[model samples]
Target: MTDSLDPVVAKFVDALNSGDRQAFYALLTDDATMSDDGNDRDLRQWTESEVFGSDGRMDVESVSDGGRSLVANYTNSRWGSMRTAWRFTVSGDRISRFETGQA
Candidate 1:
């Protein structure tokens, strides 16, 4: 995984790896939106169901657009894993929107 990434994004990556829900949620807007596989989901519910449930690690393969977007090879306990693209839209210091899918 690449180390040279935006700090906020880097913290996000770390939060995911560590399954730190409080830290992860803190980086997001109160009504942050996340879409995966083209389906919009409730962020808290999605995180509880898909993210926190799996012990996951995101091997960020590369970053672009000043670390606002990235491609990663993700590994997890629940569903094996996949190469995915993650895009974040940040407003001020918190992420307002996020989208993820097969890369």
Candidate 2:
């Protein structure tokens, strides 16, 4: 993660790269929500399957919106690699929602 990345978003990426499930979940709000490819998803279940279970990681290529939005080369055991975009909404010190999809 770069210095330009939002602290919350950077921590999320770090947790993902390190496979720290606890740390990752700790960054989210109790009712955190998410979307994938424009479809709403259950955050915890999606994280269990597509993130932790799939061994996902994001190599951020660029950041925008004060690091609230980014584009990256995201990869996972299940999907290999793809150019992806991520957008986040922060509430207090945690992420309240996020949206991700192919870029």
lDDT of 1: 0.85
Could you say which candidate leads in lDDT?
Answer: 2
Give one digit per residue, the lDDT tens place, for model 1 in 1-103: 4567767788888898899999999999888999988899988887777778877789898899888889999777777889999998888888889898889
CA shift of 73, model 2, Å: 0.4
| Candidate 1 to truth, TM | 0.91
> lDDT at 72 for candidate 1?
93
Residues 25-82 of candidate 2 have per-residue lDDT tens digits of: 9999999999999999999999888889999989999999998999999999999999
Cα deviation in Å at residue 20, candidate 2? 0.5
**Model 1: runs farther than 4 Å from truth?**
none
Quick one: best TM-score, which candidate?
Answer: 2
